[model samples]
Target: MNTTEIFLIAILVIFSAPYLVWRLGRTDYWAPLVVVQILCGILLGPGVLGAFAPAVYDHVFAPPVIAALNGIAWWAVMLFVWVAGIELDLHQAWANRRETGITAGLALGIPLTFGALAAAFLLRWPGWSGPNARDWQAVLGIGMACAVTALPILILLMEKLAILREPLGQRILRYASADDIAIWGVLALILLDWDRIGRQLGFLIAFGVAAVLVRMMMRRLGKADRWYVGIIWLALCGFGADWSGLHYMVGAFLSGAILDAEWFELEAMDAFRSVILLVAMPVFFLSTGLKTSWEGGGPAVFAAAALLLLASVGGKLAGVHLAGRILKWPRRETHVIGWLLQTKALIMIIFANILLDKGIITSATFTALLLMAVASTMLTTPIVAPMLRRLGGA
Candidate 1:
């Protein structure tokens, strides 16, 4: 078949396989369609499907076909991250400064510490750290991955639980918003290239000037015009960051972060996000899976994933429990919040992707982190639903 035909078949498989499993298997309560899609990607990757059927894999994912798919994936993830950035509710976080600070601080800090320790241990073993990574870079990158919360996925899960507009949901958003900013800031720090320091500084200076103009123009324009301009801004920022040795994803996040969410119509934002997920993000997931490897072997990868999952979940809960004690939260609130905050899907995946792109972590480490994120997200709804029910009963 031609490249176009092969690419179409790949796309068909990407969307259809996940939807079938998600719908027919009835995993919605525990594993959402997004989670299932990620799993399907892993299964279809070179490590799994390609290992068994190399001939088929080569034909289906030919170089030209893969390149075509990657173009779609890059744009898809950029837009997704940009939307997540735009949706951050920093104003709400500021309004509840004390509580948001305490919660977001402990929640991010504790996991990061534990994850760093875990990464320290992983460093003892070969094949976990990438060729280009310094010891500190590997540790910090992995640690930050554990600390990431998928703000976009968290919003989706909250809507599923019917608490998206509730007081508690709004509170959660504030905490996550604060952490989101920190996550991207730390990412920029990790990605900083000494050799390209001048370029990096230039990018920052340019961004600052451009942001002022962008914000002003956004305020004056119609919503429709703003949407068009936002994409142009997203592309420009992404290019600038990539040119500066920081990843384009960082640029994409900054592109949206400077804009006010209130500038766009809420309904339109929701529809845009949903449409992107439905149409574009599956390609990103497929691209992610294609990068997976088992160089350290399946058992080692799974073990690493389990260990990281323990660190991520344990650290999050421990930090939140400490916050509950300090802030004197209501009964069961801490448990519910901990599980909800522990949710890691899109954001963590994106974080790990950047780490891999920068050669800070190996493919084995990336595979493990991917599995940990999938498992972490799958556990959220099941655990939180029961906790919420018990809290309601009390």
Candidate 2:
């Protein structure tokens, strides 16, 4: 529990966690790594192991340590956002895919309606002393939280399961990409000052122009050196966005999506992915886990937690189902896609952290939302995968 020991543990975790994941992938127990990673954190954190070993927990999760952890979390999110952008296939979805439009509408509409209703009730309820429950900001934040679709989790699952190339998978990715852009746009409008929108739009236009220039510049660079340059550029974009009052992940995502569209072949993309995923993302995930305090207050908290979970699950189902019907898709495909899209993870955490940082939601609410995310992810993935298999689809 001393300073020396703390440093060692930090080193061990940083160096070993990803190695463990890689090794586990070669064994029969590979699927459990995600659960194990979080569970290990819970045990070694304030929940159980820390309860029994307070000094160790204090030494490890100290204020300085927590601050460092938050840095890692932000970095991890940026990596994930970068990967998200790289995965974008702009023209993949049929331009007239009724399924795309309908499914997306359902995804957004169901959550917005359900979230607003849920927030209205939560605001009126007792407990929740952390913030002014009735604040319009709280309602906006919660509504947006409920409306989130974890596009990264979807992409990861689709890729890991080797279904990324499937038609349904392509549809999900295409629809999800469009949906992600729109959702962020909606989030910006909800959160930004109305006067800033024009400036924000201007910055985006300029960023697009800059990206083209950067791509052309990169084309003249040596193949092995573009990655180093890309890192510098990524950091600059992140800095620019932060300075402009935009979130860091937005800059990272934009940089990524822009790169994806720049006619880079698989080799350049692969190199880019290696740096972002191998080095950056694990740090981000560990940081996110460390910042999050899963255990919260009393019975009222638990009730609120349950409601959040239900809203996340139920809202997605309602939205996807209605979208499918509108598009005249098969009932089973519609049902599968509904469940497939509900498992919120990476992007939800990124956006939720933004709300938490802005004081729009309390730490307790963020914790509850995290729990809702983990629960939905664990359940939805297994459930949807089997359904996809049954339908002889992805």
Question: Which is the leading candidate under TM-score?
Answer: 1
Q: Candidate 2, TM-score vs. the true structure?
A: 0.83
lDDT string for model 1 (1-394, tens) is: 7778899999999999999999999999999999999999998899999999999899999899999999999999999999999999998899899999999999999999989999999999999999889999999999989988899999999999988899999999999999999999999988889999999999999999999999999999998999999999999999999999999999999999999999999999999999999999999999999989998999999999998999999999999999999999985998999999999999999999999988999999999999999999999999999888888799
* Model 2 Cα lDDT, one tens digit per residue, 1-394: 6655665576477547646764665421223334344434434545454668888677766776666656766766676676677666766555746657777777877886787677768777533323432377677667767877777667667766667778888787777877787767766655564556666666677788889998887878875566566667777777767666666767887787776444456656656655655555555555545545534554555677688778878898888877776778888888877776776766777777777665667766766666676667777656766777778853
- How well does model 1 score by local distance difference test? 0.94
- Each prediction's TM-score versus the true structure: 0.99, 0.83
Error of 1 at 274 (Å): 0.5
Candidate 1 backbone overlaps, count:
0
Tell me how many residue pairs clash in candidate 2. Answer: 1
Clashing pairs in 1: none
